[model samples]
Target: MSHRAALGTLAIGGNPLVSRRVLSSVGEWGGARVGARGAGLSTSMASAEELRLVARIATGDEAALRQLYARYGSLVYSIAVRVTGDRCAAEDVAQQVFIRVWERPAGFDPERGSLRTWLATLAHSRAVDHVRREQACHRREQRQLPGAPSDVEEVATSSAVAERVGRAVDALPDDQRVAVLLAYYDARTYREVAAELDIPEGTAKSRLRLGLRRIARCLEQEGLGAWT
Candidate 1:
C-alpha cells in the first residue's frame, strides 16, 4: 500500500482528491485485523504493537492505517461529537484525526504518552478548533444580518445573558428549537437548515423567525432583551 492508498482509506468527505478515493483499497490490502489482538494484550505489549503499526503506516502500509483507525476511531469520534454537538462535524473531525496520523505518523511520540492518550488529545484539540471556527463564522453571519446582534460573542460569553437565552431556546417547540440551533449555533444557512431537517426552505425560515421572536419575547419579559 502506497501513501496515496493509506490516505485514500482515511478519507471521508473533505478534500476532493480524498473524497474521490475508493474504499476498494481496504479489500485489496486483505483487511488485516490487528485491533482485537491489541485490545487483549498487556499495556506495554499493546504500546509496542501500536508503535510498530505507526512505523508501518509511515512506510505507506494502508493495512496498518486501517488497523489504527479500527483501534481508536470511536474514541476520537465520541470526543468530537461531545465537544461539537453535531454528528456531521464530529465525523469530519474524526476523519481529520486519522488523516493526520496517516500523513505524519511520527507525530505520535510513544515516549510522551500512550497512543490512546495521544489520540484523545488530538481529538480534543481538533474538536475545540472546530467549535471555535463555527463560533467565529456564526458571529460573522450575525453581523451581516439586518437587526442581528452586532456582538454575538459578547452576549454569548455573558453568563447571565447566555443562561437567559439558553432557557428561552429550551422553551421553544421542538421544530423551532432544532431550526434555531442549526442556524444560530451550527452556523448553517436557512437553506442548509432546511436540507438538514428535510423541510422546505420557506418552512425553515418561518421556524427560525418564530423561534427568535419567542426568544426575544422571553428575554424582554425578563428585562434582558437589550443584549444585542
Candidate 2:
C-alpha cells in the first residue's frame, strides 16, 4: 500500500480483522512509551470521558482510537512540526504517536495526567528523537568528508570529560536524572521539559537546579570542578 493509504488505516475502525491488519502493517515502525514521572497535574485533572475513552481503546475498540486521533491529531502534528521543523517528519511522528497508543493503550495512566498532555509529551519526545537522529546522520556525513577537521588531543580530552559527566548524571536520583538529561542532553528548555515530562514549569526548574548542584558537587569532589 502507498504511504498515505497505510496512514489512513490508522483511523479505520469497527472491524477486528481490519484493525489487526492495520496494526500488523504499522508494526515495522517500532515505538516506546513515555513513562517518566513529573510533579504536575494529578489524576483528578483528567476527565471521566477521557479516561473511559482510553479504557475502551485498551479493550481493542478501534472506534475509540479513531475518536482519540480525531480529537488530538492536529495538536500532535503541530507539536511535532514545531520541534522537528519538517512537515514530513511531523507527519511521521504523529503517526507513531497514535500507533503507540493503539498498540499499548494501557500505557496511558490517567493518574499521571490528562490524555491530551500525555499525547503531547509523546509527540514532542518522538520529534526530538527524530531530529537528533537526523543531526547524528549529518554529523557522520560531515566526518566522512576528506578534509573534515580532526584533533586527536582535543578528542581524547572531550571524551574523558564526557565520560565523567555521564557518570555524574547516572549518580543522580531517578527523577532528577530524567529532568537533567532532558534539559541538557536532549536540548529541551525548562518549559519544553515540563511539557514533555508532564511536569509544571516550576517543578522542572527545581529538578534541574538540584540535579546540576549535585553534579557540580560530584565534580568538585573529584577535582574536576573547573569542568563544571
Candidate 3:
C-alpha cells in the first residue's frame, strides 16, 4: 500500500481522510472493527493546538510532545521538504527538530517567536546545513570529473526557476550577486563566502547588503513587496 494509504489506515480512529475502502475494510481487521458506520465527521486532521502542547512540553510532558507532532507533523515535514529538496533528508530534519524540542523544551523561547515559526527556522537551518554539506562534496567530485562543464550548462538550461535565477544572477554586478548566491542560496557563512570569492570580509558584507537592497527594490517595483 502507498505510504499515505498506510498512514490513513493507522489513523483510522482519528483521521478525516477515511474513504469507503476503510469503511468496508473495517470488519476485515476483526476485533479492531467498529460499527462499520460511515457518517462523515467534520473534524480537522490538525486536532491539537501546537502552542499549548509546546507549552506543556516545556514542562517535560511527554504526551504533550506526541500531541504536538500529531498537530504539526505535516507542517514541519513540509518546511523541511521544501528547504532540503530531498525526502530522506527532509525526514531527518523533521525528526531532529522534534528531538531537539523534546530534549530541551526550555530552549524554545516563545517570546522570540511562535512555536510554528521556531520549528520552521529549525527545519530551514537543518536543510541549509545539509545542502552546504552536499555542495562541498559535489565540489570535490567535480574537481575529479572531466567534461563536467557541459553537464553544468545543460542543467542550468533545464528548469524554469533555475533559468530565472540564472538571469537574476547574471544581472547582478559580479560581486553583489556572488555574495548573495553564496550566502543565501549556497547557505555558506558570510566569512566563508568572502574567503571563497577572494575578497575582504567587509566586501562580502557590503555585497550582501547591496544585493539584498536591490532585490527588495526590484521585487517591490514588481508588486511582490509583501515578500520583502
Candidate 4:
C-alpha cells in the first residue's frame, strides 16, 4: 500500500501501524501540524503510540479528542492565526474546531475526504465567516454598503485565463447579478441591499439565487462546480 494509504488504513483500524522509521516521521508531521496551530510546543514529536490515540478520535473517543488536541492544537491554531490575523480570534476558531469535533463526531466522513482535509476545510470556513463579519461591520461604518448593489465587474474575457469564471458569472440575470455584486463586493448586509434596491428582502435574496444558479449551470458545464 502507498505510504499515506497505510497511514490512513492503520489510523482507521486502530493498529500498531507505526514502524520505527514511520514513528519518527509521524512524530515530525504531527509536531509540524501542531506548530502550525500555535506558537509553543517545544518538541513537536508524537511517540509511536500516538496513532492509536488518533484512531480513537476517529471512533468518537473523548480521549482521542484530547490526543488530537495535544498533537494538533498548535497546527490548527497557527492556521486560524494566519487567517484571522489575530491571535485571539485564531485561538477562538481553533477552540471552536475542537468543540465541533467533539459535539458532532459523526461529521467526519472518510468518503468525503481525509480527516486532515476536513479539519482544514473547517478552519477555512470559520475564517471566512469571521472575515464576513468583519466586512459587514466595516460596511456599517461606511455608509455606501448596499444590499442589492451591482457587484458585477467587467469580465476579463479580456484574458483567456478567467474566461470560464467570467462567462459563468455573466450568465446571471441582471437582478441576481446586481444582488450578488451588492452583497459580495459592497459588503452590504442583505437587508441593506434589499432596502436600497427597492425590493423585498426575499426578492433581493431571489436575485442572488438566480445569479448563482446561472453560475452553477456554467460550472456544471466544466464539471468542477460539484466541488462545492
For candidate 1, the lDDT comes to 0.64
Q: What tens digits encode model 1's per-residue C-alpha lDDT throughout 114-151?
A: 67668878888788788778787775333222112323
By lDDT, the candidates rank as 1, 2, 4, 3
In model 1, the Cα lDDT at residue 182 comes to 62
Q: How well does model 4 score by local distance difference test?
A: 0.55
- Per-prediction TM-score: 0.47, 0.48, 0.47, 0.42
Residue 27 alpha-carbon offset, candidate 1, angstroms: 13
The prediction achieving the highest lDDT against the true structure is 1
Q: Against the unseen true structure, what C-alpha lDDT does each candidate score?
A: 0.64, 0.63, 0.54, 0.55
RMSD of each: 15.6, 15.6, 12.2, 12.9
Candidate 4 off by > 4 Å: 1-105, 108-140, 143-163, 184-189
**What tens-digit string does per-residue lDDT give for candidate 2 at 1-228?**
332454566545434354455444433222211221121122223468788998888788877776666566655776677566567777677777877788777788866666876898899888889877887687533212111112111233223444565677768887787777665434467897788778899999999999989988886787654322
The superposed Cα distance between candidate 3 and the true structure at residue 191, in angstroms, equals: 3.9
Clashes of each: 0, 0, 0, 15
Task: Quote the lDDT for 130 in model 4.
Answer: 68
Error of 3 at 204 (Å): 2.3
lDDT of 4 by residue, 7-64 (tens): 3433432222322123324342334453344422222222233344545655666556
lDDT (Cα, 0-100) at 167 in candidate 1: 79
Candidate 2 segments whose C-alpha is farther than 4 A from its true place: 1-46, 140-228
